[model samples]
Target: MTTASLRALLSHLIDYAGLFPPAAVDLPTAIKNYQRDRATGDAWMLGAFVLPISRARDVPATLADTAASLPLSLLVGPDDLPPPDLQVVSVEAKTNDPAVVRQLVERWQPAMVFIELNPADEREVMWATLRELGAGAKIRTGGVTADAFPAPETVVNFIVRAADWRVPFKATAGLHHPIRAVHRLTYDIHSPQGVMHGFLNVFLAAAFAWHGMSPDNVERVLAEEDVANFQFTDAGVSWHCQTLTTEAIRAARREFCRSYGSCSFDEPRADLRALGLLR
Candidate 1:
């Protein structure tokens, strides 16, 4: 694909989740960093600032002087409600029950509702409910250990299911780099290390699945660790023998895999540059 196409595919793909996990900075620090990212040249790649619903009230006061407003994605519970002025673009709720999801959606009336489901939950029922409600899904792709990373098959299944059901979804946790590799789980020097999913791997798989790629192919794409097998062009990205057109990728990005939350935006940017995908 052309550079323009690649840019379009990735536009606003990473939701800033600085308040979560390894980077867990204070609200003030997270706000400062988000503001800096918004002011940078690559700001177009940044999405909403994510924070807990309980902390929503603190955001306006904390960022009062620094940023005029923030596009937010609140991590909310089933009954939590964001303040009217929070400017929430989307909401992530931790619930496997469709009834609770329905209630939250009816009350908050967000642009998007990302409901997290248990791995063993009746996924079909949950996805069907989301489809009926016109909501979305959220997946936790990684955590602090090797065991935290879901199997490649699990992720691929989620993508295929969402594509089949036409349920848009977003991912959070452990996707800080552009490619899959063993990396430190946290910023601390003594932090544990594990194999983390690549943002590229997950999203590209979603695109391919959205275009009807077979489950095996999607799994291969997710497991791809060799950068040489993947090619980036002005028109679109190619993995091994499979190629996704720019238009297809853009459509998948828009309608299927919305975005992933990351604690550190700089890490993904740096990895992209090192791979020569960025200047």
Candidate 2:
């Protein structure tokens, strides 16, 4: 059974994006995978279906006709404004400019809007802007190539800024495992490998940051690839010398770092089991 700290830090933590590269599976196949995911008891960790606005027309009605109405997170390009007819619970776009983010919030008032920014960019001021506007920040942790992964310092910087401003944020790409490690970047047999940031490192960094850990200490957590350093208990999560109570982890997970997008839900689950994080 998963401990309280694990549950607190990981509820609805993965927004499946099977439609995006490196999985980049066809729509029908992606839908099938999501349907199968929803059938599992582990579905509680799943979030929305990541559907690109361009593929809005290709979605089958069966995608939403499940026991619970499926949540859809539409990925929009800079110029791709979604039509009013499309139904989605959230909209995601990349832009460091707060104006474009404001436009998204205006266009989709009720639905949650997350605006992506480069972690190395001036995210502190941008996060403050998002906080005042009631919008969320998004960061890409990794891509298809090794350089696609941002440095540990930048990621920790983002977490500090986002937490300081109380701006909610979500991560995308490169985080397919539960711990920081060198891993294959894609499903292809010859896929290039890189040092991918673990979901635990990122989210735990956020949780600890939200609870007032120093950025230096948080950076230590972010850079840690050793599984022995992390201890999950009924009361809280500990990373080396630092610890966050279960409630602190829960609050951060809910109000700050919301979730990460993944192309394969199974990869994360399998990795977590391999780490003995799951029984």
Candidate 3:
């Protein structure tokens, strides 16, 4: 049975990205996987489908087999606005300056916008701008190479700062596992392996950060690779010395850390099941 804390922490946590690399599936395959996955008990953990804004028009013609309104988080670029026909809930794009974000949103706005930032170089000003614009932040946690993974310090900083700024955030890439450990980076048999960040670690750390935990403790939560380090009860979640109530987790999920994207929904779900977090 999933605990109340687990449900609060994990509800709608994964935004599916079957169209992206390593799992670079076709539109029909992605749609089919999404539909099939939603039919299972695990659907509670599912979120939006990630697609390029340019492909917004194709969603309709290809979605004839499925039910209506597949929520989409468009991977956007260069003045691209989603067409009126699609259910474009949010858009994700890279930007260092808030002015660029403001200008883009002024042209056409989605319900949510996540702007990726270089937390190291961009100071508090960047996050302040996001807060002012009523938008969220985005972080790229990993890629195909070992170097693609940012140091743990970078991720922790992003989480804490986003919390401090009262900005919601989402993560993409390299967070397909439930725990942080050395894993193959790609689907190919001989794929290069690296220590990837776990989605649980990242999101739970965000929850604590949102609740005003110290940065050192937040990093501790992120760095923990042992499943034993975490204890989820019906009332709260315990990580070492700190614990957050289910209500705290729900508030964080609603306001601070929204969701993350993964190329395979099944992999994360299966990992959660193996850990006995799901039944």
Candidate 4:
């Protein structure tokens, strides 16, 4: 595929999470930004607005008045569920216990549920449980502290596990840029700094895995830091000698990797433009 086609493969790949940390704007401000972005020419690159389930009622009347309903992805507590009118597309819950997830499924009957796994726990049972229930996975790629970033091996294992189970997943936190780089963890003036995983790295790794690339090679792709190491064409994207076809990327995106949650849409757009990936 050509570069243009490759870009198209990533359409609606980012779920706006502006209400969360770092870009934690108030509900009205976040709604205003989402409304503005949805009106832009690049709106195809945007996905659902993410918010806590408890705040579903606070969605402003202005957004409700719009002709098109806003899609939402809610982060729900074990006991919480969104109101029926919110048009929630998916629900996310953080629980290592399979029992809690089962209860959530039984109660809410969400169209999609993303289970955030506990890194310290052995996830085979949980993954199997989720698979049986037809739920998806979610990984926290980074946080405010340097210690929050999981090792490359851990993320690689996650990709492999999800693929092995035939489950799709999405990532959240600390993936504001298109490429891997050292950056401050937050908007705080004295924020801690760490090497964050790049969105390109994660999605490309997922695509490569989908195409049957070895796990070791996928980890290498995830750890790639030099921008020149990657080449994007209409046919697909290449990292050094390995290439994943645009068709494969589209498939992985739709069925395996899904979309990631991002707090700042503008930052990602600007970074992509700076890298000449976006016009």
TM-score of every model versus the real structure: 0.95, 0.93, 0.96, 0.94
Model 1 ranges off by over 4 Å: 60-62, 65-68
Tens digits of lDDT, candidate 4, 146-170: 8888999999999988888888998
lDDT of 2 by residue, 1-279 (tens): 999999888899999999888999998798889889989988888998888887876666664354125578988866776555655788898888877777778887788889888765764667777888888888889999998899998899888888888889999999899889898888888998889999999999999898899999999989898988999999998877788899989889888989999999999999888888876
Clash counts per candidate, in order, are 7, 0, 0, 8
Q: TM-score for model 2?
A: 0.93
The alpha-carbon lDDT assigned to residue 11 of candidate 1 equals 89
- Select the stronger candidate by TM-score from 2 and 3: 3
Q: Which pairs of residues clash in candidate 2, taking residues 3 or more apart in a chain or in different chains?
A: none
Q: Write the residue-wise lDDT of candidate 3 on 43-144 in tens digits.
A: 999999998876666655547435236888888875775566567788888988778888756655756889988767657777788898888899999988
Q: What lDDT would each prediction earn against the true structure?
A: 0.86, 0.85, 0.88, 0.84
Clashing pairs in 3: none
Q: For model 2, where is the 10-residue window of minimal lDDT?
A: 61-70
Kindly report which residue stretches of model 2 are placed more than 4 angstroms away from their true locations once superposed.
60-68, 78-87, 123-125
Q: Which candidate is the best by lDDT?
A: 3
| lDDT of residue 74 for candidate 2 | 88
